[model samples]
Target: MRPPNTPPARAVSTPAADDTPAADDTEFRTLLDRLSDKATADYYNPFTTFDWPASIPTDELWMSPELLSCHGTELMDELSPAQLRTLSRWESVNFYSLNVHGIRELLIEVTRRVHTPGFELPSEFFHHFIGEENDHMWFFATFCLKYAGKIYPDRSVKLPEAPRDPDIENFLVFARILIFEQIVDHYNVQMAADRRLHPTVRHINRLHHQDESRHIAFGCRLVRLLWERLLDRGPDEAARHELRGHLGGYLGRYLTTSIESLYNPAVYRDAGLPDGFALRKRLLVHPARQAAHAKVLHKTTGFLQRIGVFDARH
Candidate 1:
């Protein structure tokens, strides 16, 4: 079943020659082709890429302390080192679980659109996109299963239904992809660099970030191309307005849900906290946490606003 508020799966019409991407859009097609080539060359077997120790070392942290669920708050200070370590490992599992589920949804979106009536050259890159996403899902799920005993269930963001116009629908899907990659990349880089973490954990973060860097670059360029088309093509003011509202609120809700995943009852319970949900509420509302959330989302939100796709006041 489709999760609440998550974007509905799109159904694309059979491709036709007339619907091939415009010849004049050479730059966009060329860029995607170039990126696709890079992905192929950079491919690695996630299963064998990391030296997964027979057992993950419990002495080391799994994530950067600063990126912890309760970082910068009184709740964070309340934890002993042992409790903090447990939280770090569980939270790392939660993070990877989100990536696994997010990639699952992304695969659905791109699989349907690639080679459809409206896609042609870009379909070429969609092949790379889909391939890379599959690898990502595998590594993330594998890590969770091997180290955490179970993968965290998807409770991140709930997307709304798809938009009526294909242009708007495409825009939103790519935008969501961009949002997800950027946020996850933040954790990847931070954890990858933290020497206190296990080698396998660091390798996982580093490897994923390397791939995600390309993904994020492609996402930015693709969104820009789509935005230019929106400017020149259809979707009247009313439609644009509605999409803008959706983008703003969708991102707002996405950020909220992503952060809330940190406060999962399991993380707290594992960390030895008696009442997980109560502490979660308090941490979420903390002044420091609020600021941190805004900071985490700042760059991507700014980019969307600059492109005129997101209107916060709308």
Candidate 2:
């Protein structure tokens, strides 16, 4: 990441010579207006929204079986039913902890751009986005600390050095946020509807999915607009191809890393499993787990391809 004091590479305020809203720009503004209004209408006080139970039963599954990291692997068969339930508890805590960290990082990134030069058009909705995400971070952390006694410390490693180009940097920031939300929403949508899980678990997941639907919509449109703007600068075919390749490589690594983070050794240890690190490594390479990761990322990868952020050949 660039130093906090670094200036944006290009100011988005500069438009084509005519400086009029293009057709896509008009559509984007329309979306902003509609989504902002929806946010206002749908707003709730997260503080009072959930009737958090005194205790969530440890005997019941805290996470859906299908969403578990070991879901399709032979590891699942090896674990007894009681052990699976225990594992779900730690896994659930780990999942919510990830949300807390993810929301924090995204909030910082979005805040930096909220009212800045290139972000004037969406700044209005950015208020709603920031507010809602803050609420999300709070509720997720509340759940973790209230039940599990700790929010798992963020274990994600530093990513490879990013390109120095400001445009690519901006695109990557929002694109990564979108990818994170999409992958999370995949689990949210499933767990929210799974009757087997506790009502408290289902309720939080349901509420998150409600808000994330809007955020994801906004993110998709914004990423596409940014990519189009990059294209409008008229990079040569070779440069455009290179940009695509770089973006593909970066995003692919991000996707893999995101999946791997779910298999935390701490989660295994908390669940009373031995050799947590070895187990995590084994689970990651299992063909079934790879397929599960693909399923989780399917919507996100498809969206990137549609927006030309990823080459179709990939």
Candidate 3:
């Protein structure tokens, strides 16, 4: 009945303000404090993380073919070999473009919260986070611009729009973003260690992988705390049901991408392919992508399983 922005009539509940972390939402505040301490102790100079003295190999493949497009064959197995190669190159561009765009968006989100009134504790570490992501965005774009020649514009995946329910919206955003980063982290970690990659490329991944480990730690801690608080609100059964429904929808709907849809099928038409949508459909369920999904989704899957959000799928 009151205005939507009004605080809950009752005091918002909080996790036990202790300084330890746990899986089942016990001692969350305590856990966050410990996480903050770790970030401080483990801080590094981003500029020095990679030695720029190293030259890069322009002809070397930055990505593997299994990670590349099958000329829409996964969905539209009707392409010529030439078309598949074009699809492969475009898929590479698309992957790096998403990284470029997604990191920028995350930078904005963290920046807004970093200096805001209620965000002090988390923002302290986010200061480091923003710096690290800035470096990541630079390196991702560096490769895209230097090699691919142009960064692709962002694709439409309008995720932030939510229903009228505030609790439902907040929970959904956290869950979706958590899943997104978890998937990308798998690639970053692998490329970081791949000796075949140019030093710059490997350095980029190594730096990002290091920072992401911390980001995941912080994100998991924050989401678990937030989830506990949401469940404890003195809501009627219907409101609680709606919240749970929102969580389930996010859990199921947004965990993975359809790789086939990644490179525009027009790309195939230009390259002389028969149909775009069919090819996209084929690629979406390709074994390589499924493996990519499994690798990136591992941590999120574990988190969700522990939280009882999804039946254990692994």
Candidate 4:
């Protein structure tokens, strides 16, 4: 909305007067040790992580039925338990396929920064972040390929990358990263703890959650740090307006698209539903489905609202 290259105010970082070297170093080491140690013990090779089951059992539900897009609707209830199991398998495949796609996009952005200058302090943790994300992509893709024979391709049209003032670019990037993590985390935490899902299905979710917990923590802190620095460089009128608009519009699109992306017609077609695309379209606007989406994003939405990233109207 604003013209590009708005000049920024002088930078002002958070206070550090009481923070002596010993105290600061102690806290930094604690976080570093936590991530490094987790990588040592919790790391997995996608090639051998799970004894890939010969097949998804027909009788056992592969995903919690309640988590489905059509869940709680008359349509879902109409299906027999056997049919529900079929849907569960298809839904799980679709869900993990999404994880793979999202991981790929974020990895590209993270990789670009990890190797560049100015990331020295956090460089060690970035190694763990990159490695964990790579492993996640592998395991998620493995499940879909093994069970569904293919990962669902992303259908969203790629929009041209938006231009941002260099001063606030880092804030926007980390904000995007944090929102993405928080949204998916809604599912990862639930499914990881959901005993109803198959062992292999739950294991992958559990592993992903374990690694993502660290990423989410790091993202939250980093976003706040960047946000404070951006605020310190007092923005011009145009920059201030653009920042507000970006927060609202960016959050709106993130929440809406993240939910919409889950509805792949192929998933319905595989479950033997006729007119899969039509059903997907119908379910997208369904009230119950919309409510389910709200549930998924409740924590994330609340967090953003608290941080002023999303306003009351949002």
Q: TM-score, each model?
A: 0.88, 0.95, 0.73, 0.85
lDDT of 2 by residue, 140-244 (tens): 999999988899998886677677888878888888899889989999999999999999999999999999999999999998888888877756988887878
Q: Which tens-of-lDDT digit does each residue in 215-300 have in candidate 4?
A: 88877766666665555465585775567677567557756776777788888888899998899889999889988988887876
* Candidate 1 residue runs with Cα over 4 Å from true position: 1-24, 231-243, 312-314
User: Between 1 and 2, whose lDDT is larger?
Assistant: 2
C-alpha RMSD (angstroms) for model 4: 5.0
Please, what is the whole-model Cα lDDT of each candidate in the order they appear?
0.75, 0.87, 0.59, 0.72
Q: Give candidate 2 misplaced runs (Cα > 4 Å).
A: 1-10, 13-19
Model 2, C-alpha of 118: deviation from truth (Å): 1.6
TM-score of 4: 0.85
Task: Give one digit per residue, the lDDT tens place, for model 3 in 1-314.
Answer: 00011111211132345734234434544555666677678777665654564334434555544445552234335544444555555555666677787777666555644645434445566776677678777877876776667887765344334565555444554565566566667767776777755666677677677777877777777666557667778378687667666666656655643222354565555446668667656656777656655655677878876875666443
Candidate 3 error regions (>4 Å) = 1-58, 69-90, 115-118, 234-239, 257-277, 286-292, 311-314
In TM-score terms, candidate 3 sits at: 0.73
Residue lDDT tens for model 1, 77-140: 8888988888888888878888888889888877778876656657888888898889888988
| Model 2 TM-score on a 0 to 1 scale | 0.95
The lDDT ranking, best first, is 2, 1, 4, 3
Q: What is the lDDT of candidate 4?
A: 0.72
